[model samples]
Target: MLLKEPRLNFTDVMNRKAQEKGIQLDNDQQRLIRHLETLAETLLRRRAAFAGLYLWGQPGRGKSFIVDSFFAALPLAQKKRAHFHTFFRELHQQLNGQGLDAALLELMGEARLLCFDEFHLHDIGDAMLVKRLIALAIARNVALIFTSNYPPRALLANPLYHDRFVPSIALIERHMTVMALNGPRDYRQQATGHGVFSEGAYLWPASAARRQALGLPDASGAVALTVGHRTLHAASSPGEFLHFTFAGLCEAPTAVMDYLALCEGHERWFLDGVPPLARVSPAAQQRFINLVDVLYDQQRRLFIAAACPLTELVAGVEQEDIARTASRLSQLTTE
Candidate 1:
C-alpha cells in the first residue's frame, strides 16, 4: 500500500492507502487531523512540553498510520515511540533494576515526546500501572500520544475493577483531547492488487532432499520436520516465516478445536484463507478471535491472506462482536 499521498488528510491515510486511491475525510475528522497536526507542530516548536492526546476509533480507521507519519516527519532524536506491549515489557525490565518511580520519572524526563501505539486499558494490571505512569509523566511535562479502540471514558471496560479507572479517566480528560475518527468504509478494502506472504504453510522437501534441491533451509530455519501429519517449512526471517492456506492447514482427523490447540505454541503465523470460522457461525467467530488473540499475546507475527489487507477484514465483517475482533486483529499488525 502507498502510504505517501500528500493529498490525503492525516486521518484518511490508511483508507487512502488501502484503496491506492484517495478517500476524503469527513469534517470532524479533518478538524481532528488539524488538531493533531497543531499538536505535532507545537511539540516541534517547544523543546519541553508534556501532555497526552488520545485518538480512538474502530479498527482500520487509520489511527496508527497518522501517528507513524507524524513521527516520521519529525527529527528522530526528539522522539521515543513503541508499541504498547514493548513499552510495558521494557518498563517492567527497567523497574526491576531501578525501581518503578525512578524508571518512570527517568523515561518521562528524558522523552520530549512519547507515543504508545495501541494503548489499551482493558485489564486491571494495565489500568493500575498506567495510572501511575500517566501521573508521573504529566507531572514531568512529557508529551504523549496514543491510539485505542475505546474512547477515553470507555477504557478499562472490565466491570470487575471498573471503579479503579475513575482516576485514570479523569486524568485523561484533564490532560488531553479525545477524538474519534470514523469512516463509511474500511480502508483495508482497497487492497485490490497487493500480495501477502507467509512461510509456515509452504510444503517443502525432506532435509537432505531440500539441501540437494534448493541448497538452503526451506523457511523455518530448521531441517525440515513434520509436525503431526503436516510438514513445517522454514523461512529466512521471522516475518517471512510460516503461512497456511486456511483450509489445508485446518483439515485433519483432529476436530477444528484440536487444530486450534496446535497453534497455541506458535508465536508467528501467516493465515491465507477466510478462516472457516468466519463463514460459519457467531460462536465460530468468537473462537477465531480467541485464536487470533492467543497468537497476539505470544507476540507472534501474523500475516493474513485476504482479498483485501488489514482494513477489509474489518469492513467485510459487520457484526459488532466480529468488528471488535477485527479491531483486535488490526492492533497486532500496526502500532
Candidate 2:
C-alpha cells in the first residue's frame, strides 16, 4: 500500500499539540518525539523488520498524549487505534464464534498502522491471545504502535506464566523499537482543566446532603439489567443517569465485557457504596479497576460516592494498574 507523507513532521505536530495545552514537554517526552520521528520515517518508507514501536512508562507521563499525536499525524488509510482491553474483548467475542484465523482477519480489516493504548496484561489467558495477535500483525505487515505502562518483558509477570510469555516478549523485542517515557511528573494526575473527565467528581462519605445538592439519585431499589446472557441487578435510578452499587458493579461475576456493553448504553455512571480497597475481595477490587479503566479511557463521566476519601479508596492496592487507577481517579473532582 502506497502511503503519503504527512504535511507536518512528527516533532512539530507533537510540540504544537503540547503547546496548545500549555504543556512544556519534559526531557523524556521530548526524547520520545525524536524516536517517533525516526519511526515515522521508517513507516513512511513502508514496512521494515523493526516496524513497530513499543512505548512504556510509569502512570501518566504523557504516553497517551504522544501516542495520540503520533496516531493522528499518520496519514495511513487503513490505520486503526483502540484501547487494549476493549480491543481484545471484542476480538475474543469473535474468536469464540469464529476461531483465530477468521477473527484476526475480520477484526483487523485493513490497518497498516495499529495503535493500542494502555496495554498490559494480568491473565495468562489474555497473554496467549495477545501472542497470536502480535504474530498476525507482523505477518500481515501491519505497522504497529503500542502505548503501555510496562515494558514487554515485564508484562504477564507471574512466575508460572512468565516463561511461557518469553517467546512473545522476544518476538516483541525483535520486531519493535522499545522506548521508555519515564519522567518524574504524571501529567494525568495534574489538574489541567481536561474536559469531560475533569468535570466528573469523586464524592466521599456518601453523604445525603452532597447527593441531594448534586441531584444524584439514590440506590433506593434494585433493577435488573440484561448484559449479554447474564442478568445484572444494579441500584435503581431516576432514568436520567445509570446508578449501581459497588457490590453490583464489582463484587459479583462482572468482567470488562459487562462494563463495555453497559458503557455503550450509558455515558454518565454512578458507583456508590465504594469501600476502601483493602476491605473488598481481590476479585471485586480488580473489577472496579477495570471499571475505572474503561470509563477513563473512553472519557466517560464517573461520579464515585465512596465511604472514604480518594487516597484511601485506592490506597495499598498492589494491582499492576493501581497507580494508573490512582492517576485517573486523581483527575476527577474530589468533594
| Best lDDT among the predictions, by candidate number | 2
Supply candidate 1's per-residue lDDT for 308: 40
- Model 2: residues >4 Å from true position, as ranges? 1-7, 47-50
Clashes of 1: 16
Positional deviation of residue 261's Cα in model 2 after best superposition, in angstroms: 0.3
Q: Residue-wise lDDT of candidate 2 within 1-335, one digit each (tens)?
A: 87655543888888788878778888878888888787777666664553788999998888888888787887656789999878988888897868887897788897778899999988898888888888988888887888888999899988988999999999999988898988888887663776676677889766799888877888777898998999888798526678999988799899899889888888888888889998888888889989989988777888989888878888888778888888888888875
Model 1, 1-335: lDDT tens digits are 86542332344443454355465556656676677666765665664556678888876666765677767755436678876655665566578767778877766656777888767654597678898888877777778888877788778665788788988899898888788877765654332311221221211212344333423222333333355555543233323245454443433222223333445555456554444343545444544554454454344555554444455444555333456455445433221
TM-score to native of every candidate shown: 0.61, 0.94
Q: What is the C-alpha lDDT of each candidate?
A: 0.57, 0.84
Report how far off residue 123 is in candidate 1 (Å): 2.2
* Each prediction's number of clashing residue pairs: 16, 0
Worst 10 residues of 2 by lDDT: 41-50
Model 1: worst 10 consecutive residues (lDDT sum): 197-206
